[model samples]
Every structure is written in structure tokens, then in C-alpha cells.
Target: MDADVTDSAGTPADPDHRAGDTPQGRSQEEPGATDSTDGSEPVPQKDAPQDETPQGEATDADAPQGSGDEDKAESSDENKADREADGTGAQTWADHPKDGSASRRKRPWLRWAALGASFLVMISAGAGWWLYKKLDGNITTDTSAAAELKVYEKERPTPVVMDAQNILLIGSDSRSGDNRKYGRDDGGSQRSDTTILLHLAADRKSATAVSLPRDLMVEVPKCRTGDDKETREQFTQFNSAFELGGTACTIRTVERLTGIRIDHHMVVDFNGFKDMVDAVDGVEICLKEPIDDKDARLELPAGRQTLNGEEALGYVRARKTLGDGSDTERMERQQRFLGALVNKMQSNGVLLNPTRLYPVLDAATKSLTTDSGLDSLRDLYDLVRSMRDVPTDQVQFLTVPRQPYRQNVNRDELVQPDASELFKQLREDKPVAVVPADELKEKEKAQDEKPDDTGSDSESPTPTPTYSGSSAADDLCEQ
Candidate 1:
């Protein structure tokens, strides 16, 4: 049978009465009832019925909907924190799920390439510096010549004009080392086989190389030798001064003879000259007739040919076989050979190519013995730089006007007024007469052929006094 349920007040209840139904019905009846009864803030009871539901059903409904959103928010916050901690906010797509990372990856390779290029440049610079030092170290200086020259510094000729330069070039024939193979190695005294006084114009437009004969008779002044031994002043051949007292005595003698100041001097030996010739590959020469000389060890058929170092030495030294056995003819041949050598060195194949330039510089510096003014590579470079722009045609070679000595037929004597005039011109820094008749004729022909295209009136350069000399621009094979 159905039992009747009553409330706590003992009143009769409905037949369907429930235990939790009373609290929910009272909450709906008076929303402020709980607050008034407790004298405190009311508790939120809107979700009380849902909270009172079965635990399994509540978890299923809430966790799948509301709680799922809360869990996703928390997970997102954690991921952001991880990214901040790892400092990967700008991570690439390859490393993370981001766009535009391919472009960023490409930049690293470019940066590395630039860095590698810079490293290579630094290495190349270091290598260049090492090469410079190596080349600079090869040069040898003559301290003895410098010290001895200092003693007579006061006696040196003063420059008549600014920028006029004079240099003495001496070819030493000392048969002690490599040169001994070429000549008698009898332990003989060294002599100046060749002597040239080079004069550079004040304007730097022209140059003149005057060859002095070794057989010329001159009065050598008393000089102190390298060993501090003094020699009495005496009359002797021009080369004898060098034998007695070395470079210092030779310089003093030259100054006394010419009355022109020498700005610097260089002494070159046989080995050095050969090496220099070889460094440039070879120098071209033209022979008018076949040469077969046992003494000079030179054998060549007549015509144009390139001469190696050994052949060059022999060709320059060949006297009795090549020409009339006169020193003057040999000097002329030397001048021609030098002109060709200069042309070869200045060519692009040698000057522009580092492979060729290094050997040539090495050979040149190793063989040179210079004065204090031009003792180092830097000094020599400066000198060369000054003359690099000089035209080949303006480079002249001549012998001092000479005649047979009155006392001895074998010796030479300076032609009176002509020699004095040449020295005066050099002293005054004036351009000497060096125009060859052939060149003059060519110039006249060119002028006659040229049409006056522009009516511009340009004044012509003053004609230099013509002298008996040849230019470096002259063909080596020309008769």
C-alpha cells in the first residue's frame, strides 16, 4: 500500500513528495529568503540542482563542452611561455610551422659567402706584404762607397738648377767570382770596364747617357782608399783611378774632369748583369756580319736575334771580332743593346705581369750596389718612377767629343771647345743638341705631309742643338 509523506512541520503532503524538491522550490519562491534568514550575503544557488546531479552525468556534460575550452586556453598559454623561454618567436618554417622561413634561410648562406671572401682578401694582402719584404731584402748597399763619399761631400758639384739629376753607372770587370769564368782569373785588380754619366733633364722630358772611354788619359787626384791608405796624385788612365781607390776615387776624378756634380752612382757586376738579362728573358740584337770570337766565346750568324744572358755578355764584350777592335765601337754596340733591353723591360709582358716583374726586380736589386742616396729598394723605386714617363725617343746616348791624344797615339783626348760646351750645357740644365739628321729629315717630311686641318696657331718647340748621338727609339737593326 502507498504511504503518506509529511513535511517537518507535520502537515499532510502530496502523494509525489521528494526530499531535495523542497529546497529548490523554496529558492524559487523567495530569492532573498536565504539572505534574510542567515543575515549574510546569499549563496548562488542557480546551478545547485545541476551540482546535485550524478557525478558521472555531470562530468560527461561539462567536461566535453565548458571544461574542454578551459583546457585548450591553458595549453595555449603554456605553449607561448615555452616559445618565450626558448627565444624562438622568430623561428623558421623549416624549424617550426611558420611562413617566410625559406627567405630567411637563404640569407645565412650569403652572409657566409661574404665572410669567406673577406677572409681570402685578407690572406692575399698578407701575401703581398710578404712578397714586398722579400723583394726589399734582396737589395745590397755599399756602405764603404757611402762613407768614403761623405768625406768629399763638400767637394761635390752643386746643382745648377732644380730637378736636374746626374747618376754614374759603373760596370766593374773584377775577375774574382762568376766573372772569372769569362776572363783571366789572375787575381788582378778590378777596373771600370764601362762608365756612363746619365743626365736627366730638369723638365724630365729628356735623358742623356754619355759614355766615357776607359782609355782616356786624365790626372787622378790623390785619394784615400777603402783601407785608409792614401795614394799620391798622378797622371793615369781614367779607369786607373778606380783601381787605386775604388768608387770614391773614381767619383772624385769624374767630378774634377767634368765639373758636373754626380747625384748618385751604381756599380753592377757580371753576374748581376747576366741575371738581369735573363730575368727579362732575353735582349734583342742585330748583327751586320757573322761573329765567331774564341776570346769572347760568342758565335752568332749575322741578322736579328734574341741574346741570352751569356751570349749578351759575350756580345757586349766582343771587341776585335765584332767591330774594328776599337773600344768606341763596342760602346756603341752596348748603347744599342741597352736601348733594346729598356724596350723589352718596359713592355707589357714584363712590366705588367707579376710573374715576370718579380724575377726582374729580384735580379736587379741583388746585382746593384748604390750610393747612400739610392741604397734601398724604396729609393731606387722613387728614381725609376720619376723617369718612367720619359719617352724613348728622348733618351739619348753619346760619347764625349774626343780626339787622339797628342802625346800617345793609343790614348784619347777631349776635343777642346766641344767638350767644354757639352759640360756647360749639362751644368746649366739646358737641352743638348741630340737630333739625328735622319730624325730631322723625318720630322721635316711629316710636317710637309700634314695638312693644316685646324687653323690654330701653335708655336713650335725651340729646336735643340744637334749633336752626334743616337736615341733609344732608333731601330736596333738599323745600320
Candidate 2:
């Protein structure tokens, strides 16, 4: 059976004007209004007496096809609707079923869901922006050092390589504020406990860190102090430059020695170092002998052990208890430990994983005081990201060649040509090689153990020259 078409909510279908309506039914309509049903002509009330005409008497030409009685029934309904509209207000789309249904079918939940999704996106975006701002703000700008550098801008060395970069990393031993727990607070006075000249190759395939000994004597330039007073230049210990005139003074001293432009610098305090170590959980190292240093606040056993921030700091800084009790040994330990730290970060997926990376970034940013070039989070992130792909074997750590000074065996001076060659290679952005300390030791031992070849004229193959240093990929366990 054919079903009757219906409106929304199962309501019977209806048109604007029924085919059975009479002239009187439209009598209550306003004047000059045209009949809207099927685009018919207007029904003018020219015959007022038609209202009283026989109810069932319909002119075939005037009426549409339908029974007279049915027309009378529909006409009655129309008359009632017209009368009600005249008494009350006209219907709006919300009240009229047909008009309201034509406007739209409402699905309120879908609307709420759209609004909810929009709100959630806004909240997430806000949180991300806030986090970026916080991290960006954490970096402290070395404006004072920058200002000091500007004063000697002309005196500074020009850059040799366009894309290559050299950053002066100074580990400040300042014992002020929270750092006092590590040592005495000498009224904010401090020295450069450790300094490394970090170079990044133009191709981004390698990085080399050269540690400068604190006892190495060099010519210190006349630099302006915090009080804006300049002191006379003199030949003195390298570390004294920091104690005398801060970062700018140290930079000047290093420039005079290396003749390489210092593009940017970072000064990290003792607390910062500790926090960074802790952020990466801990760095693992192999200890040959037991250590118990009261001054460094470190105590450990011989074996493979992971050292936390506090223990790691002490392990790197303890001079008298480790190796030959010399600053050279201390610097070597520091470099090797740093290499282990870098290897851990790469191997443990710290750089690739965001959850792990944030803590490390927080620790580093909080502790770093950098120049204007690298004082923002974006700059630092870009710098780190560029080096993330560098292979561990290419990341080398070594010290500038040095030997005991003739004037004092306790002091040191550059090893002349070896030091100059290294500097020249770096300044020209050329590749340099490094050998692991333990591997070098084993080779030396093997050479000593071999029998004397007095009867043989065997000539050894020429070997490529390499520095006595360690890479991040060096394994102490293999020693």
C-alpha cells in the first residue's frame, strides 16, 4: 500500500492554502496581500455577500477539484485559523511546524561538541605558548659581558670560517646564593673553574671541545672591571683573567692566545652543573680505584658505577685524590666524564624523547648565562638540534698541547708548534683526529712488551697524526 507522505515528527503533510478555502476564509487577511498558494492570483473581496452564499454551492471554475462537503470542512478550518490570527499574534517560524522544519533539524549535542573541541584546542595552544615563554625567559642574558666585549670589538679577532662557530664554555665556580653549599661564599667572587673552547664544524658532522688549564700562563689584556675601571695588562695565569675582569676579560685573554674569534659564550655555575647531571639521571663511568675525597664530598668504590650530580661534580673536580693530582689530570677527567654524559644522552634517547628532553632543557637553561646571540630558547634549541645528528666518534674532547714552563715546573706553557698547528687547523675549519686515552695506553704497553728487532730491518707504516684525547664513543670498559 502507498503510504501518505508526512512532515517531521510524523505530522500529516499540509500546504499553505487548502484547495477548499472560500473567499470569506481569506476575508480576515490584510488588504492588497496576494494569495501565496501555488502562485495563484489575489482573492479580492469584491463580493462581500459571498460569505453567506450556500456553504456547499461551489462554482466549478472558481474552485479546485475536491468534494463540496470536503471543501466546506477545510474552509471551516481556514476560517478558524484566520480568526485566531486576527485575535492573537501571527506565527513565527519557531511556532510553525512546517516553517521551523524547513529552517533546520536541530542536533544540539553536535553543536556542543564543536564548541567543546574549539575550547580544548585553545587551551592546548595556550599551554604550549606559555611553556615556550617560560623556557625562553629562563635563560639569563650576559648584557654586561656583551657591553664589555663591545668596548674591545675592534681588538677582537675576525672570524675565519663563515659557517663555523666557536663558543667559550666557562664553568664558573661562584660560591654565591645556592652555590654556597658547594664551597665558601667569597662575597660573590669566583674563578673559571673550567673553560672549554667548543668548535662546531661548518658541515655539522663533528664537534671538538678543547679544555684550557687554569694554570696555563698567558697574556691578559687590560679589561674594564665591574666598577668600570680598567687595569694594566700583564702576563699571568689564564684563570686569573676571570677573577680579574669577568667574562669579557677571559674572552680577551683567550682571543690573544688562540687568535680565533669567540662567537658566543656561556657561564654556568656549580649548582647548574649538578642539576644538569641529575636531569639526565646519572652518567656512568668505570673507576679503577676507590675514591674518598672530603674536600670534594665524593666517596665511591672501584667498578662500573653511575654517578649522580653531586658525586659527578666531585669526581670531576677532586684534584688531589685522582690520577697524578695535577690540574691536567683533572681536566682530562672532566672531558672524559663529559663525553660519557653526552653518550648517555644520545644512547638513552634523551634527545629524541620530549618527556625526557624537557627536564634536561630546564636544568640547562636555568643554569646558563649566555651572550645575546644564544640567550633565547629558540636559538639554543636550534643550535642543539643542528648537532643532534653528529656521530659520537666525531665528537672529540682534548686539551691544547702544553708542557711545564721553564721558569716554574708547577706552571705550564703551550707546546709551541703542536699547539699552534692545532689552533690553525681549527681556525681554518679543517678536520682533526683524536685517540682514546685507554687505547693509547694499551698500544704503548704493547710496544714496550715487544722484543727488540735488532736483526730485522722491518719498517713500520706511517700513521696519521692524532691528538691524545677521547671521543663520546670511547668505551672505558674496553681499556
Instruction: Specify the highest-lDDT model's number.
Output: 2
Residue 197, candidate 1: Cα error in Å is 0.5
TM-scores of all models?
0.73, 0.75
Which candidate achieves the best TM-score against the true structure? 2
Off by over 4 Å in 1: 1-82, 86-104, 186-188, 435-463
What local distance difference test score does each model get? 0.76, 0.82
Report the lDDT tens digits of candidate 2 across residue range 28-76. 3453243344656554433223343322234444456674566445333
In candidate 2, list every pair of residues with a backbone clash. none
For model 1, how does the per-residue alpha-carbon lDDT over 2-73 read when each residue is reduced to its tens digit? Answer: 010111113334567776444222222333223223355544333233334322222435454555456445
When summed lDDT is taken over every stretch of 10 residues in candidate 1, the lowest stretch is 1-10
Q: In angstroms, give how far residue 290 of model 2 lies from its true place.
A: 1.7
